[model samples]
Target chain A: MNIHEYQAKELFEKYGVATPKGVAVKASAEYSTALGQINTANGIMVKSQIHAGGRGKGTFTNGFKGGVKFSPNKEKAIENATAMLGNTLVTAQTGPEGRKVQTIYFTEAANLGKRPDGRDDEYYLAILLDRATSRPVIVASTEGGVEIEQVAHSTPEKIFKVQVDPAVGLQPFQARQIAFALGLSGDLFKQCVTLVTRLYQLYWDKDCAMVEVNPLLVTKEGQLLALDAKVSFDDNALFRHPDIVALRDLNEEDAKEIEASKYGLSYIALDGNIACLVNGAGLAMSTMDIIQHFGGSPANFLDVGGGATKDQVSAAFKIILGDKNVKGILVNIFGGIMDCNVIATGIVEAVKETGLKLPLVVRLEGNNVQAGKATLAASGLTIVSGDTMADAAQKIVKLVNQK
Target chain B: MSILVKENTRVLVQGITGDFGARHARLSIEYGSQIVAGVTPGKGGQVFEHNGVKVPIFNTVAEAAKQTGATVSAIFVPPPFAADAILECVDADLDLAIAITEGIPVRDMVRAKRAMQGRRTRLIGPNCPGIVTPGRGEKSHGGCRIGIAPGYIHKRGKVGVVSRSGTLTYEAVWQLTCKGHGQSTCVGIGGDPVNGTSHLDVIKLFNEDPETEAIIMIGEIGGNAEVEAARWIKEHCKKPVAGFIAGATAPAGRRMGHAGAVIGGAEDTAAAKIKIFKECGISVAATPSDMADALLRIWKG
Candidate 1:
């Protein structure tokens, strides 16, 4: 449900929050036209657009000097954009594998020279739901250049928080309070107040799960600009916002995860060999737990849902076997209203169609247990049957390790 | 006596004409739940037959409550309007309303929760499986079932089970039933991020109920509800409490298919809770079968 920074800034602009002038360029061919859009006095900042944070400090695996580089002219801007476009970016958050940088944003760099207070021109601001209070909280700090997580972990006292009552939305007084907490005055302070207020308005109106403005800049002229932005929307609330849903980038997500969501299935890819297909969320977790306990790693976390049909079950199984790393498959069903016979038939059909070549173990319990077990047994596949959860987990782990 | 509903407890169905509502409504009546009325907006004045037992349908929960005098209401409304349906039951001043719908937006539930502050009505499961208290006598609605749980699996006994999952609660109950220990009641508080009830809420109810001797808490790697309950159990709970937590080996940050199943930044993982439960004198079960053995030892102690 997370949107890219450029998309977030576009949405922010609609809510009257001023974002730095930038044009998202997907290719070096369009770099000249995009650079022409942002008319800056000293050129622009070329930022590689990826989903993960720490992109500013990220490096391109293609031997590019930096994912983000300041270009003094149009020539250097295209050089930086060419280095980033279609290159993989490796940051602390992107893991060792890194994310592919599909677009580079050519943005107007702000003049955040030295302030009179001798401090750098960076501040941290974010709005997120505080689970402890079950309310939206605005977190602000003066130190923003470093990773906010490190600041949050070490010098938490430096971080200030104010919870917003949804009934009142984001009041002007609360925004001013945050503005004052960050130590601002005169025209600069008033600008901060206006910027904070508009940001809160966008967060509230857009139904955003999180709105983070790390290194919210305080320019030499006292004007504020969001140097970096990240926004994630509530997935359940996406039904109300179709325009926002269209901003979802499928290329940024795992293909299996996107495919699973299409079928109303929940799948999380893991680095294990045993694929787990269970009924409920808790059951799936427990199935994974016991597998690890018995010395087996889970290939993926797949839930076919409580009321899944034969086709959905077959779909779930095929998705699991699609992982070539799946040395074994465990079909765990605790059928209550979920007919056990239907699950058995689905497993049988999926195996028949996919042609199972690995170890398969199944444990079925609950309503129509007799018929469901009968169906699986009659499938005539060389599938191991387990009477209990522990027994089933042990069987799969053992059978897989034997190879 | 059970915690919430009993045989004589009159049940009202909200979103009665909907697929889940109509189906569970019939199933509830067959299980001996005294389903007095049904509520579906604009579907009033209709007679719904459940196992040949006729029930009246009302347009609103207010009218249904007024006419049927139903003490409890269970909702199967869709996610978008599920909170409002719950609010209707709350406004009608029902003792409890169980929302069986899943995928309700957290913001809507948070507002619903705030409006429920100091209200007479109690809520359970926006995405949860309903509450079940096994019928004890002839007058009992076969043991009152306010959810989709089948009645055949339950046995009228003392062990109380509270869980954060749907079918996993069924798994725990089956394990208990197989171990010759029938449950007094089982509550699935749903797996949503923000829910009305918690493991501690039902644990408190079970602690007070004389019928519930020992308790089984089914928690996963999520919010610190399990750890909080473990802390409370160490100080106040008089009866033995056994717990089974899922997601022992789950990776951090993944949602694990349940909204409330993510491991928090703090010490809220299953392994962390197991360590806490061990320190609190609560038997922690690794597998569901291990829970059956642990519960047997706990009640016996």
Candidate 2:
């Protein structure tokens, strides 16, 4: 549900929020044409478009200096774009493996306003659901252009939050309160109020999970602008927003995760040897934890949901085996609404279909579980049957470690 | 002396005509719950006949409640209309509305929950397994089964179980049943971030209930509901409590199947919550498989 900075800016613009004019290009051939579309007079900021944050401090695999760069001229902008596109970027957010840069964004750089003490006039602002209150909250801070968590941990007093009543939406007074809290006044203060109002509207109208604008900059010319945008939409609400769903980038997602979705399975890839396929979300998570607790790492977290057919279970097995690191598999089913026999039959069929070589340990409980265990037992397969979740995890960890 | 629904608590089904709703409805009826009526918007005056029992159908929850004296409703309406279904229960002034449907938009729940403020109805879940008060019959049959949980796994006893995950709750219940321990009531508060109820809310009810002598609380990585409940238990709860938190190995920011299962802040991790449980004098289960035993270690029978 996470979108790139360029897409977030486009969304911000659609809702009347002010942001620097920017152009995004996927190919090098479009770089000059894209640059021609934006205001690059003072300087053009070349930003690598990836889902994760810390792009400004990120380094490319090809030894490129920065994922985001400021070039004074058009030629320098093109050169920086050339070095960025198609290169993998490694940041604090992206793991050591990093993500490949598929798109480059060029935006007009702003003249940062300086305070009386010569500090940058920037602030952090984000709109998200405050789980504590079950309502939308606007988080504003004077400190910006850095991790908000660090600011929160270090100086919690600097953070300000305003909870909006869902029935009434965001109020004008609430917006003004944020603007004043950030020490804005006069025309800049008016601009901040307008921007906060528009951002809240966009957040509510678009069903966004979070809309964060780090470094809400005050230009020297007295304009408030969102310098960096990070927006994520709620997955549950995606059904109502087709336009937002189109913004999803499959390239940024793992292949197994995307494939698992097709079968109504929730799959998250991890780095380990034993893959777990469980019935429920909490059980699946605990299945992974128990695996690690038993001295074996889990390769993935896969939940087949409360009800699964033979085909879905087979698809789940296929997806688990897709990960090369998987040396063993654990199937833990606490069938409440789901029948264990169906899952067991699917496992037998999937093992035969994929010619599975890795060891699989299954612990089926509740709702015709005896039939399920019998089905697995009669399949003439080498599936290890555990008495409980802990037993299954230990068996798989032992089996995978034996290799 | 169950917390929410007992054996005779009259219940109704909101999407009784749909496949998922009808299936669980049949299961609930087979388990001997007093399923009095069905709500299908336009399928009024029809009878949902299953296993010799006939449930009268109504066009709205108000009419259903009025016709059958049903105080509780298990909502199986789809995500798009689930919020409306919850509001209908609130408007009808039902005692409890358990939304068994999953994947409801958080925006919808936020608005629904706000509208439900000071209302008569108590909401259980938008994506939950529902509540169960085990009957004294064979395999816990004749019990009041509200949502999609297997009734047979439960046994009417002095223990109370509360969890955020459906099957994980079942795991603990089964473990307790296997250990010859029975439960007074088991409640799944749902795994959504903005659910109708919280761990603290249910724990308070269990603490006051005379039948529930011990409690097992299962939570995962997400909101501070578990922590809040644990803190409250430390001060107010008068029973031996066992707790277990899942997602110890889960990565940050990843929605682990449940929409609310994502790790958000420092205090929302499993390790952090487990530490709080230990400090709060609750028995902490090292793994999911040990939930029942963890309680047995502290409270005997």
- TM-score of chain A for the candidates in order shown: 0.96, 0.98
Q: Which 10-residue window in model 2 chain A sums to the lowest lDDT?
A: A335-344
DockQ of each: 0.69, 0.88
Predicted structure with the largest lDDT when compared to the true one: 2
Off by over 4 Å in 2: none
For residues B23-74, write the lDDT of model 1, one tens digit per residue: 8888888888889999888889998897789999999999998998997999
Q: What share of the true interface contacts does candidate 1 keep?
A: 0.65
With a 3 Å backbone cut-off (N, CA, C), the pairs that clash in candidate 2 are: none
| lDDT tens digits, residue span A153-239, model 1 | 899988999998866678889989998998888886888888888888877766787899988887777678887889988788899
Candidate 1 chain A has its poorest 10 consecutive residues by lDDT at A112-121
Per-residue accuracy of model 2 over B1-301 as CA lDDT, tens digit each: 9899989999999999999999999999999999999999889989899999998899999999988899999999999999999999999999999999999999999999999999999999979999999999999999999999999899889999999999999999999999999999999999998999999999999999999999999999998999999999999999999999999999998999999999999999999999999999999999899999999999999
Each candidate: what lDDT? 0.85, 0.93
